[model samples]
Target chain A: MEQNIIVSVDVVLFTLSEGQLKIVLLRRERDPYAGQLALPGGYIHADKDRDSLASAERVLLNKTGLVSPYLEQLYTFSGGVRDPRGWSLSVAYYALVHESLLVPDAELRFELWPVAAVPDLPFDHNRIVDHAAKRLRDKSTYTSLPCHLLPELFTLTELQQTYEHILGVALDKSVFRRKLPELDFLEAVPDAIRQGKHRPAQLYRLRPDRRLTIFDKTV
Target chain B: MEQNIIVSVDVVLFTLSEGQLKIVLLRRERDPYAGQLALPGGYIHADKDRDSLASAERVLLNKTGLVSPYLEQLYTFSGGVRDPRGWSLSVAYYALVHESLLVPDAELRFELWPVAAVPDLPFDHNRIVDHAAKRLRDKSTYTSLPCHLLPELFTLTELQQTYEHILGVALDKSVFRRKLPELDFLEAVPDAIRQGKHRPAQLYRLRPDRRLTIFDKTV
Candidate 1:
């Protein structure tokens, strides 16, 4: 029997913009929900791409002129009812990028919608977004995953604020500050400080080798 | 482009035998590694299977007579060089089963090999086994995943030994017993005890409606 599964990759690119979680959505350029807002996705290139990850990278780069530093395979969704053409399977990926990377000069303009208030998307995309957001929230509580939402160098206050926004709970300032050093995933940047109206605060960055770190307990 | 990607599903069915982690492997019946030991896998029936999980369940049932209750979707592996027939992608799944469910009489007899000493397998099956074992071990520390490896009724000592066997560490007996109630995933069976020559010890099972639970700290 011949199999004709429509295999594709969808990316749920998340960023913290103005103290809110946002995801990038693009307008489809072809039929089957054409000109509608959906996640940046495309069919896997069998000849050009090496694998699904390469296909995801190519789709993100082509649809939005931004490259994500942290990308992970979220989950796969499939069924015949998901696609109007035929049976389809999507290997969804969730990526975290700094808001500063989304410049306003891309050839094809994409919209950044708040993850909390996203509209109805085509082809089971809303479900994908919800799954990705839940994953981001769940991992942010126990791992250093939320650090990707901030810029390269940031103050501890800004980092805590980012965590609070994602976790939706205010962590005790003293407890949070005390646990940072024990967690040991951050290091103060030499001679780096943020110039604000108040007294300057020291800036910190993730350790050189700690791309992603896990904690034995919730942070 | 005509996408000729061969999408398939492979299952890493894990069980505990002689206090060692083992996975089920089947001998391929057709060409392209015929008669070689490999993970139970088959092509996705585009017309018959609902999704990747359905395909995995079907493949596991056809290859092995037993059905696994705790099957989870693991990572996906894909590339051109994996399968000799053509470019292929495999959505891998890991399943946990109690040893009692596996009967000796089956149409196509399967072999159980310890995860640590598994010999060379066909079609990236060795890599799949390693990945499944790592996932199971990692989750065993903070989640109620190891409970699936034991029979319906088990003593606390049996459960703790299962954990120690999978984690490859000796946990303090008092500390292990204290954390079980706080985790609240297991409940003492109503007036049940293990028949033994010494004193009859209480038997426990996973709490009703608590299939899988995560803990803030390691159990």
Candidate 2:
């Protein structure tokens, strides 16, 4: 049996900015990879932490001073020699947050790098980020766009644009609108409208009853 | 930082028998939860094991003489005190195999239990099994039905029955058959046929080019 095996949680926090997907990375504070950029994460507290997800949440709050609106357990990477310190395993997580949440925070100790243009990251973080990005794109095709990435209220066109940006594809406006019926989580904001170039577009926000999961039914 | 944390890999291996979905379990051989039924697992061997998945595959081959046809990473379990040995984490995996692979080995130490009627499993094994069962059913609805669970060659009726058993629902025969064209994984076995009571049903096998993944396009 392997001795001295430590468990940690690494998070691939994702958001959209300038019409592109981005991930948040923090500079490592300790040796073994100090000064190198890596995903925001820390060791799980055996006595204090309730679970791996909680540990990841703690890492997020400590590094960025913001809370993720949507987070899920991604793959666990314990393949190669990721840690310079003996054998260790990291339970990775992927989270979604609105770009606006972090854009105004000048005190954040992390940098948001475009998903495609990410430089070399320490450990297996680059591989972890790649997996999470693929997961987000795959889910976006079937599930409703992550509302947390947008403002409190948005128009249908704006929602469609978000999906297009994440999926890296162009969707027909009419076809995309037709699928809105299946997304029962969205609720029309009464009397609220977004003035567009041609006319005022109706505004909608995710219903309070609906959780982050936009659709449960199979696509 | 939490010290003395151990990481292990637990596998929920699934197969079909007697038209029912079943999972394999082995009796524990150690203390803390000795003599109780539990998922086959062991501590990660950092010295020899290449990765967590490799540890899972090693455990499968060591405990059960047969190798799995399909295996996927499921959720990781790290809740309350699941182990008396202190804080530990299990990187769980779910595998699929044909029942015929194990039915011939009467000396195997594992027992097959229906997914719905799983008895009390020690150390969060039950929760892990529950999550794997739900994952199998969910994937069965949209994915390729895990053809590895069936013989190399099979009839459409036989394949549909496998789907029905895993999903616990009767699929419309015509509708189910009509969807096969989209699967593209199943290739007709040339000149092979299964003699039925009324007529002979054509046999089909997975195409060499197509891997296990059946569906790539959005539903």
Candidate 3:
């Protein structure tokens, strides 16, 4: 009575490059939609993978060549018509990394598309990208999720701009800084300062072991 | 080179009974774990099921004989050793309903286990239950998730009590009522009032299509 469903993992690797949110899409080297750029995905190897998470990590590593520091299980998209082969289930995950980590090489074979205007893609990949983008935007309002899109050491102004960019709003600097003490997700690098056009600003990084810090109020 | 992995759905249907959070479990009738009280779960028929959500709703309604309004995709649990029958995947979901809906019948073979002290269940069910309970508790602090455990019409005191019960803390009546205007999820039901020993409290129902409302700050 086995139904023989095809299982796979897809990663929506998101990065903020040039002040715009973008996701990585790799050209499928094999059929269903070969030679077309799609979300980095592949079939789950039940024998080699310890579980679905391991499968997702492996697929991301193989397709993107960068191990993301903040990978989360987004959602599971499944249906019969989503694939031509058979009934398929994509255990989708979303990852956040700085753009500097995605150094393009000769054989990387990947392209980045901004989340606002993702082009038509094969299967239900567009829908999966939309869902992942919405989750990131919604969570960034009250969590320290946007910090993942920034480099390790960043100034307070850069962090606030990251939040504002993801939220699509301008926040009052005083109000944003007021909530930072209680949020308590970032720690200043001792004596580290960035010299910009203005006076030097302290550089802060996410506190150790505080990856996804949720705040009581919106930033 | 098919893995022949088993795909299934498991539901952690929780309800508030006598101020306790409990989940429903059913006795398996077939082999592999016959007569063992486990989560209400079954294999997904790729031919008959539309999608994973449809499969989850079908399994819950068929096994429990009651439809839940607050069913949501909890998480996907998959591995090789969770089940004795080789590699498996279980797309888990969680549902919240009032205890009055669980009407016991002679033919229905099910039991309720309090989440606080769940016993040794079969096939990683205990772990699933723990995950669902944690999600509910954490979301209750910022979202109006616990309100689903109340009847259609309830008093503000009842709503606050429900939150307190799920959060495992005592909330001040004055502070909770102060946040009600900002929460704005409930509407007074047409001047309806409930008579009690001290005074009549106004009856309220959730505002139209306002399920799972998020608050700006903690109550």
State which candidate has the highest TM-score. 1
lDDT at B65, model 2: 79
Cα lDDT tens digits, model 2, B1-219, are: 446676889999999898888999988889867888889899888888877878888999989876766778887888548887777789999988988887536556898999989999888898889788888888877766567788899898889999988888899999998998988788898899888786998999878767563111111
lDDT string, candidate 3, A1-219, tens digits: 577799988989999888888899988888978888899988888788888888888887877788878788888888798999988898899889999999878878789888888888999999889888888888887777899999999999999988877777899999999999988889999999998899999999998778863111110
| Reference-based TM-score of each model | 0.95, 0.93, 0.93
* Candidate 3 per-residue C-alpha lDDT over B93-178 given as tens digits, one digit per residue, 9 for 90 to 100: 88898888888788776898888878788888888888888889988877668878999999999999998878778999999999
Clashing residue pairs, candidate 2?
Answer: none
Native-referenced DockQ of model 2 = 0.50
* Tens digits of lDDT, candidate 2, A152-215: 8999888988898788889999998898888888999999988868799999998887766411
Per-candidate fnat, comma-separated = 0.48, 0.56, 0.56
> Candidate 2 chain B: minimum summed lDDT over ten consecutive residues — where?
B210-219
Clashing pairs in 1: none
Q: Tell me how each candidate scores on DockQ against the true complex.
A: 0.44, 0.50, 0.45
Candidate 1 segments exceeding 4 Å error: A213-219, B213-219
TM-score for chain B considered on its own, for each of the candidates: 0.93, 0.91, 0.92
Q: Residue A28 lDDT in model 3? A: 83
From the highest DockQ down, the ranking of the candidates is 2, 3, 1
Q: Relative to the unseen true structure, what is the C-alpha lDDT of residue B39 in candidate 2, on a scale of 0 to 100?
A: 91
